[model samples]
Target: MNILQLSNRLGYPPKDGGAIGIYNYTKAYHDLGHDVTVLAMNTKKHFYSLSQLPDSYKSLAKINAINVDSSVSVLGALMNLFSTESYHISRFISKDYDEELKALLQNKEYDIVHLDGLHLSPYVETIRQHSKAKVAMRAHNVEYMIWERVAMNGSIWPKSAYLKLLAKRLKKYEAQRLNVYDMLVAITPEDSKIFKEDGCNIPVTVCPAGLDLDQYKVDKTKIESMSLFHLGALDWVPNQQGIKWFLSEVWPKVNSKFPELKFYIAGRNMPKNLLNMNLQNVEVVGEVESAIDFMNSKSIMLVPLLSGSGMRIKIIEGLALEKSIVTTSIGAEGINYEDGKNLLIANNPDEFVTQIERLIADREMVNDLGANARKLIENEYSNFKLVESLVEEYKKMIV
Candidate 1:
């Protein structure tokens, strides 16, 4: 099968959930000997160019990444609303991208067109109406849910109101666009429920995210120092909020109990506020070369997420690396794990402190949980297992 995938960002570095999803799927399709072509946005506001395709990658399709014009930033999104429909559409739609896609579909025959993430949903209608291929939307998350979580978790009401309006528009558009695709591929059944609740009467498949277990392995050196690690894109509100809450409320208690234990925060775009936070035991390391490296070194990974959507890839990666994970009920959502078996569940600051204390004090318990978590990941979230399921879904869509 000839597969064409459109993504909003680069998937190689695996910086965030969306990138990780694209990278794994592309690798899977390529390994199956299917012709795969990728069109990634490279949303970072910088000039990016591609040369030779990776040896693992089959074919080099169109690469349309360009500097995000300041005129097309969030301010631009607002401005485009008042401008011509072309500009309004262009705000979210990349002109070069659309032209490249049209030419590709017109020139070559593709069995499947996998539009990755709702970021590319704007182009779904155009492809469906004009192209001759089976179209599917792999929604990373209901975008509105992210904004809604941010709004509810935010402390200030005025800021929340603005975000609330943005969420409203995005939610409405997300629901309306579901009809444009033949199938909606979600990372979890919970996401499918959201689509159905929103009146999207389309075929939905649960394609959970998987990790590269080979690339990530358990490091015994990581266990030498008792450390708690949190990793994700710090620019994300949920992560930022989680850290803020942890540092303010939870960290004090944890630090007082174990003054020597280290808490490492690592991710891209670390806010100055978080970086400058003068906590005794907290160290905010901004953007490590490899998150897996940090995870391997840590004794425990903390997922104190207050509000967010979708399956937390961080949790999957941590578990895959065999790290003892201490996460909130919300943080551990989507992953099927018994509270005391695979991972520790903590709801509030008190629970978080208690779990951390138990994990730090009891080596046997932490090892048990880590071993179980690793086994669960090997059995469930391995790339081989997930890709097989995804391929089956793709076959169903084409047939």
Candidate 2:
């Protein structure tokens, strides 16, 4: 099948979850003997140069990236208050990107045109006008749901009010744009249900992010048995909010109990407030060289997400690496993980402290949990299986 993937950002260097998700699918589709072409916007925040990518990867797909200035301007954001269009979706609409996409449709026919995220949904009309490809919106998350959670968790002041307004605008946009696609490929069954509830009449499929297990081979000998860590994109509001909650409420209790235990935080674009935080035994290492290497070096992975939607790709990668993990119910959502068997699930500060202490005291339980977590990935989240299913879905749509 000929596949054209439209993304709001580059998928190479798979540093963060979003990039990893996009890159893995493209690679899997290409490996499955499909002609896959990725036309991604090289945004200023997550820029990539085509020259930097390996020739081997380039051979898999005709990877083309166009420079897009997706930077959020205060003035533009203020102006959006008067406009009915969603600011979140509007920022991604570039004339150059549209022209490039138009040119691609004019040049070659495609069996499937997958929109990598909701940001690219605005281009569905263009895709329809240019080609007869089956348009599939691979929703990374219910875009409005994330903002709704943010608004709910925020204070009732001006910030919260503004977030609520943004959520309202995004919700309307999401609903209005629902039927424009041929199909909706949700990352989780939970998301699929939400989309249906949000009035998405199109056929929806549950296609969770899968791991290339070969890349995540775990060596127990290299593991740092005493360290705990959290890794994700810190610039995201949810991550920043979760980390703050952890430091202020949960981390202090855990640290008091285990005074020697050090918690390492790593990710891209560490905010100034987070970097300047003076929490005891908390080392904020901004952007590690390799995500797998960093995970291998840590004994336990921490995902203290307070508010977010969709699946957490880092959690899947952590489980695949056989790392003992402790996360909130929100953080572990869509993974179908057992609380005590696969990895620890904690909802509050007390539960987080208890889970951390349990892992610290019981080595055998840690090993069992890590092993179970790895097995979960092997059984349910195979990249080959997921992509094959996606291809089948595409075929069904085309027929």
Candidate 3:
């Protein structure tokens, strides 16, 4: 099959979860003996040079990237206040991108044209006009729901009110655009259900993010049993909020009990405010060269997400590496994980303290949980198995 994957940003050098999600699937389809081409908008924030990618990756997919400035401005925000269009979605609309896409569709016939996320939905009509390909919108998350949750958790009046307005506009935009595609590939069954409830008439399927298992194999001997770590894109509002909550409420209690324990935090785009917080035993390492290496060095992974949607890719990678993890119910959503068996789930400060303490005290329990976590990934979330099923689905869709 000739597959063309459209993305809002370059997926190579998969630094964050979104990048990893896009790159892994593209690689999977290519490895399955399909001709895959990835055309992405290289935004200023997550830009990548196509020439910098390794030859092995280049051989897997015919990747191309075009510059598109997606930065926000004060004037643009004010203008959007009076318009029906979503500021979030509108920012991603570019004439150059549309022309590039139109040219691609005109030049080559494709069996499937997969839109990577909600941001790329604006070009559905363009794809329809130029190509006979089956259009599939890969719904990463109900985009509006993330903002809604953020607004609900926010405190400041004016800022929260503005966020509520954005959420309302985004919800309407998302609902109206649901049936525009031939199919919807949701990242989770939970998200599929929500899309149905929102009146999405298109066929929906669950395709949770899959990982290359061999790359994440566990070597327990290398792990520091005393170290705990939190790794995610800290510039995201939810990560910042969750980390703040952990430091203010949960971390203090845990530190009082185990003062010698060190909690390392690492990720791209660490906010200045979060970097300045003076929390005891909390080390803010801005970013790491390799995610797998960082995970292998830590004994327990912390995913203290207060409000976010979709599966946490880091959680999947952590489990795959056989690292004992403690996360909130929101953090562990979409993944089929059992509490107390594969991982520990905690919602409040008290529960977090209890779960962390349990892992700290019992090495055997941690080992058992980590093993169970890796077993779950091998059986259910293997990249090869998931992508094989996805290829079958593509064949069915084309027919």
| Backbone N/Cα/C clashes per model | 1, 0, 0
Tens digits of per-residue lDDT for model 2 on 79-98?
A: 99999888898999999999
**Per-candidate TM vs. native?**
0.92, 0.98, 0.98
What's the CA RMSD for each of the models? 2.8, 1.1, 1.1
Weakest 10 consecutive residues, lDDT, candidate 3? 217-226
lDDT per residue for candidate 3 within 69-103, as digits (tens), equals 98878999999999989999999999999999998
Consecutive 10-residue window with the lowest summed lDDT within model 1: 83-92
lDDT of 2 at 90: 91
Model 3, position 215: C-alpha lDDT score? 77
Task: Evaluate all candidate structures by whole-model CA lDDT and list the values in order.
Answer: 0.77, 0.90, 0.90
lDDT comparing candidate 3 with the true structure: 0.90
Q: Give the lDDT of residue 37 in candidate 1.
A: 78
- Where is model 3 more than 4 Å wrong at Cα? none
Models ranked on lDDT? 2, 3, 1
Cα lDDT of model 1 by residue, 27-63, tens digit: 7777677788787775553223455445444343434
- Better model by TM-score: candidate 1 vs candidate 2: 2
